[model samples]
Target: MNAFGMNAFGMTALPTRRQLLSFAAAALAAGVLPRRAGARPLDDVVAAGRLMVAVYRDNPPFSHRKGGALVGVDVDLARAIAGRLGVGVEFMELTAGEAVSDDLRNAVWRGPVVGGGVADVMMHVPYQKEFGLRNPEAVLFGPYQREGFALARNPMRMTQPMLASLPDEPVGVEIDSIPDFYLLGAFGGRLRERLVHYMTIPEAVEALVKGDVAAVVATQSQVEAALGDRAAGFPITPVTFPGMMASSWDIGMAVKENSRDLAYAVGDAVTALLEDGTLPEIFRKHGVTHNAIPVE
Candidate 1:
């Protein structure tokens, strides 16, 4: 992914409103094809015979590149959903934006001017009420998996699995992530000075494995994937702090607010996948444990 969070697709320079209007005028004069009037996102996708899915790039065990091919649980899930929809799948790799709302705008509803516009659907959206309320332009549904923060500690440096032990030694976390904020204010801010921020969770885990930090805090699946073979040595355990809203949260998919049909179809596909144990099977292929989110 690039600095702007664009993946291999490369970010296109966004054109100004005047430039867009001029271009549209030129295209119209040239008799360029326009979208069918009043077509919904799902209708456009189905008519084009392709389902474009936005997923985070460089996020392992969920969505990432391997052997020059995109492979991860989210990748598989997207493909499965596309298959269920009887359309070809296109995975748009993206780096996470400042917030899920930004991601929804850039990837789900309003496409980045650079990436040929927004995708039909985006995966790994937080299935929370407050977020949905805040982002009325997007629809969040189809909770597929439950994820929680976890600590992976180097046993030689940290004897206990608790978050309180991190003050004496540095702890690693992805910069600007939930764990980063949590640790910064944890224990009355005692661990603030000792918090080591990295660009990503895998980087933090690597620092922990190298003994540069006493522990690393990230998602459970991320810790597991980063530990890999060394998982036997570094113990991963769920961590909690006072005033935490919830230990775990459900991850789902998001579509444009107008694409309720698309959301429903994707939700049905997810249900079928879960019922046949395909989602868990995808997690197993990535060597991470899956915690199924009960359908509500």
Candidate 2:
């Protein structure tokens, strides 16, 4: 018996399309709806609507272009995150070294970059003390995986004595990477004294295949992917670092300092997945063997 046939509860009006969509998304997350109603949290995300996932597309097996689609471990993870949020995924190709470059500094996702807002979150970021110190705003997610490098060699050439005597062999490594740091510093500059150095890990792999060098030290992921694919005939194997040379590292999604709310949410999401064994299951499907890195 009130105005517009509404009661005296001060009824405002019908729900907007955006509100309807938002409610639906929350319902979907809560499992109240089974159809995955829509891919939009509120509205179709036609405007102000995209979760940009920044990643390095070149270094394969992590983030890369495969089958004309943006794919890899990081890619799948990003899609899953967006799907949970009821949002569409947008691939933002990026790398770590160029983090402070003009492109990144001016990148824009939500608001204006002048305010130092985030354009996208970087995925598969290695936990580095220097990076954390420099970008106090940066936050890493759970240790999605524990990984290390090893010298893969042909089984025919493998021997316990040869493995033990590797310090004297010419080794290949990339410039300015963990391997380079380990070999140059941890190895007592032994690579220079014994193993030959390569401009890249692949170069070293080539050297190993061609017998140019005895072995090359590289990440397990890189070694596995390369050898599994085009390098199938190489007959490579792995040798984990001896003892606790370096504590295992946890790599995760990297969010800007300003977007702490988003960071915390994402971090929590990752941690929850780890706790429930979801993340590990995905890694298993990808054939990525790793240790679960707990998120504090």
Candidate 3:
């Protein structure tokens, strides 16, 4: 995992999650379709009467399966955007690839080798200038949320939000995550033995509840969603690591470069949703805190 990047896409495992942050150069798969011919324009999408939206499969609080139905913030947002556009919504669930660039190629600008065509828009893309510059084939826009790390601690065990308390109190983190690495090396490695690793943030939060760890460090949304009603006692607050590379980042949507019109239309729709309070409500419904993107 690149220390400079957070696992914004919410892949279940560390290896795949790490790959999403690299944003490195990548080649499209052999079966990927040509960009200009593959990406549908706004008029073409309207003519089809439905907007195809791509979301990462099994990404909770964002996109995931619940009661055998696909749902989450991204899913609801996609439906709302399509509704605003006067079209039906169709979802194309995506599996995380080796890098975010690969995902954009598969989800926004090109079709996967197995022949599923790209979606008109892909949700939960990292809205970073460097990333956008590296992948000119896709346009990144509509930053809906600012994602960052937070400490969710058991009040009885950890009275303070500061990392200073972690030396004696165990801290849980997703194995190989930025938080995990941060806890391992931060404070001159004094807290190494106190670090507990889990496969996911939910698991780490579970440990916090069970008294297995005094606190769990992870993305704010994951911490909030995992705690749910139990969040009443546990406090969620930000803590800075002395040498942390990226403590937070904005997340948005991506469209094919040729689909700038679609991007603009979707961005406008999101702004309307935010202004009308629908966007924050969507996040609340999923048990996640809605951290709005700062106005640029």
Q: Pick the candidate with the highest lDDT.
A: 3
Looking at model 2, report the run of 10 residues with the lowest lDDT sum.
Answer: 1-10
Better structure of 1 and 2 per TM-score: 1
Worst 10 residues of 3 by lDDT: 3-12
Residue-level lDDT of model 3, residues 113-154, one tens digit each, is: 556678999999988887788678999999999887889988
Error in Å for residue 173 of model 2: 2.4
Q: Model 2, 40-125: lDDT tens per residue?
A: 22232325457766776565677777777776777777777666656677876753332332222223222222232334566765
C-alpha TM-scores of all predictions? 0.80, 0.63, 0.89
Candidate 1 lDDT over residue span 1-296, tens digit each: 22122211111123447645654554454243332222146777888999988999877888988999999989999998899888999888877753455577668765553435667788887777766885677899998888877889888888888887764888898886667777788778888999999997788888987889989998898888878888899999988756765667788888888889989888999999988988889888887888887645
Off by over 4 Å in 2: 1-49, 98-118, 128-133, 161-164, 167-169, 184-190, 193-203, 206-212, 229-247, 275-278, 284-287, 294-296
CA lDDT, every model vs. true structure: 0.76, 0.54, 0.82
